[model samples]
Target chain A: MSGLTLIASYPKSGNTWLRAFLASHLRDGRPIDLNADLSEVPNLTSRSLQDCHAGLEHSDLSRQEVALLRPLTSRRIAREQPGFYKTHDSNLVPPGAREPAIPPDAIDRVVCIVRDPRDVAVSAAAHFGWSLDDSVDRMADTAFCIGHSPRRLNANVEQWISSWSAHVESWLDAGGVQLLMLRYEDLLADPLESFTQLCRFLDLDDTRHAVSRSLEESRFSALAGQEARGGFRERSRTSTAPFFRAGKAGEWRTALPAVLAERVVGTHSRVMARVGYG
Target chain B: MTDGLLCGWRIRSDIALPELLDWQGDDRIPDLVVRLGEVDERLPEGREISPLLQIDGTGAGLLQVPMVGRFLVRPSGGITIAPQPEASEAEIRLFLLGSVLGMVCHQRALLPLHASSVAIDGGAVAFCGPSGMGKSTLALRFAQHGHSVVSDDICVIETCEPPRVRPCFPRLKLWRDTMEDAALSPEGLERNRRGQEKFHFRAPHAGVREPLPLRAIFLLRRAGSGEGEGIQRLAAPLDIMAALEAETFRLQVGHALGRAETLFQARALIANDVPVYRLTRRADAQPDRWLDAIAATIRG
Candidate 1:
């Protein structure tokens, strides 16, 4: 395919896990290094990657310029370095840009993994050094974005990820590309079946052995153990907790405050219900 | 009189270039001429080497930035700028000295490494890495400790025996936090772009007037978890060759200019002559601690 195959999701929505699974599967279920091997599916918003493709430094560019430049760069990457790329970018057009960061023609397909916003809120609070309330508010904020560190350089480029619902709808409703929407809970409940579907969608070997061995290699315990042994590069420096913290789904029930949970549900209830989070 | 002296080249420009050093040597003719002209949207026979850049058969390149202007860089050291109406002089000069300077290096058959450098005992030591790897931060740190800043972003090197780095501009594009941490004020400094917090800090007194013999290169990298953070020299010949090739600035433009074989020889010469080290630092940046270490390593 002459376009990008995106493993797209909002932050803390099992995007890393999917990449890990794919990384192991691509290596034929070999044990993978948490830091070294994940580059098999590099982040689309990574600063170096964006700079190399755009032929300009994003640090020297304004947010508006970056917004306009991303689509052109995306098309270039689609034509040249076409393959799987992980991204948190929303499909909607950003303010002052003609199109989304990655246009439809630039995309071959998207496998979007969604988590329960309540759980996302809890995990995000730990990962971004925010409180549960702050996380919930950010998830509901229509103007929310990431990787634009105002005072310093972030490792990745600016990704326009609006509200959780807007982000979810952006990829799922996107046209002219193949879309596979999977819930994070489904992957936890049945890794074999879910990853089998994932492999098939990506045109990988979907045999039971292939799926099961890759699943075992990318099991939450193994990944978390690797992270515990050697820290994850993707972990935020400001992150208050481990990157592989609490991989289970219903942690929000115990971790999130009742008021904050209600706030997330109030804003993302429609999208949540549609994705079977209800 | 020209506005700036860059890499021993006297630069006469149609626009302001406050970030560069004053022209010092006897001026026979300007090594580079920058003129304001009506540049066309495209170049004749220009193939797109990058999103903003195109190179023609004569090795002339065109660079078009959306808000900034288009730059036509010819092999004869001529640069024509057709700037946007609202573009700031600082913004225009930034690309002229950055991407355009890199293009000029390829045109002139010089090697440009994407690095930030400072003088250590009259020899240039370079730090190369991806953006946000604190290359400029490290240079700024050394500058604070009384070392002369050699160049930032693109370090121009003559790939002769015992390669020499032509001292370029003394401007460092530092982020807001780096400024605060380095105890430098960004007040009245120019931002790299409009509404961006990154600043183009001019270190006037700390500029090196002459080229320094290229001493060593340290490829800055992050120490992953449980990994040791220190400098390790590259031993294998192929690894050194690969590192030099990887660190070359605007390598694609060199290839597009049909200078790939020359570039390969340049990389081979650098790899054979200079000692390259992989300097792994922890993700948490503490450049002050490594300043003395870098200086000592360079001296050795």
Candidate 2:
């Protein structure tokens, strides 16, 4: 039995933040270097791993081929060592495939971090260089996905991000792996309690001092400063905004236009209420 | 089975690999052989050579390639392939040309580099990198700019005095995006495989049959933030060695075949014989600008 913990989330969520916090806490309250230590939590859909396993370039693979082989490849990698991997893909089985994108047996536990859709729209708009209306439309579209660029290779595989409601619901009902749901808002509002629960879920040492220090060290302000100095590698090429932009949760109230906010709520209100975002 | 000359070696294979340029029929003994035979899904008990390759003994190893097939390279210069049940012949042939052929080169003690080359002013200029780094795309851009294509994927380097690169084939495999960017249509071209958007465009001019003297090698890299787009000469011996080693095709298999000495010799021969440079370009930079820069540098 391999031990693999997944830090799964939708795009523009707090997946990277969670990874940074985990990396800092794991290193015993060491100050996190955004570039150096970020590799501690590698992305599940790394291009090198996929190319090595598939014995061909990822661009040569069809979308379904990439989807079908991704889980098997990750399973093979997980067998080598136990570690955390971040993914933005939804938990869904491809056409004619028996397993979802992430094999259940390969993962022992999953920490799914979800953010408010309104905030996600605002951040995604900046992150992808899309207008606010377009971002909201993408969030509401059931077939929305990332990494469809035809110009160059994307670091991650083609991720199927269903509508925000469906995305949250699928992970909640994902079977086999033990699931621990965390809200990005809770992480911002109460860092100690939220990260404490997270550490407990992963069976890490949740001492108060370590958790408090890690929370302070991985604060958004600190990460933003690091990005300003060295620049974040994960920032999209088209995006002009920095990677760690506006980590506050409720800024969407001011950032997102009224019509777009209503649309996000109208489409994702059920999941929002279920996750207490409403 | 068909007979063809690939990288100056006569090859007979059970399947027709369209990527390799055709050679005149001959009675000379084949330097390599590829045939269909049963192969185990996993390699037999042996030392793990590379992540995807394993060797049980000298000159005998198994290559388990995902989605394409399994290959067993025997000491007798023959390769046995067991393709995946669902893979098409087109897909199988592509992998055979890229990875399988590279492994064969290693078994035969030849150095195969992961690169694409274009014949520039009667000399070879090679671009080496991992896949999807636009190696083939850059080569095609050179060909479109009237430079002759030398190779598409694997550049075979012979370790003779003043090492030379033998042209592999005349086709450039391109994704749909690249074809569209170049304003070429994929409507009539053969796709690499069914459902894959990649198409193979045969070079408009015939490839140079005679080996070209190695001129210079440029390692392609995407420009990082705040980094300028241009060619920087790699002068340090260690840096040049690292760049060459990173581009060695099926490097783990080469080590397992007890060719480490030969591989190191080839790297040294190339590093010392040719000037190596790192060409960094913006991801969105116009291809012509960088291509012109590379041509200007080579001409000077």
Best model per lDDT: 1
For each candidate, C-alpha RMSD in Å? 1.6, 4.0
Candidate 1 residue lDDT tens string, A201-258: 9999999999998888888899999888877889997899999999989998888888
Top of the candidates by TM-score: 1
Using Cα atoms with residue i matched to residue i, what is each candidate's TM-score against the true structure? 0.97, 0.83
DockQ (Cα-based) for each candidate: 0.77, 0.26
> What overall lDDT goes with each candidate model?
0.89, 0.81
Prediction 2 TM-score vs. true:
0.83
> lDDT tens digits, residues A176-222, model 2?
88999999999998999999999999888798998999888899999
TM-score of predicted model 1?
0.97
What lDDT score is found at residue B257 in candidate 2?
Answer: 78
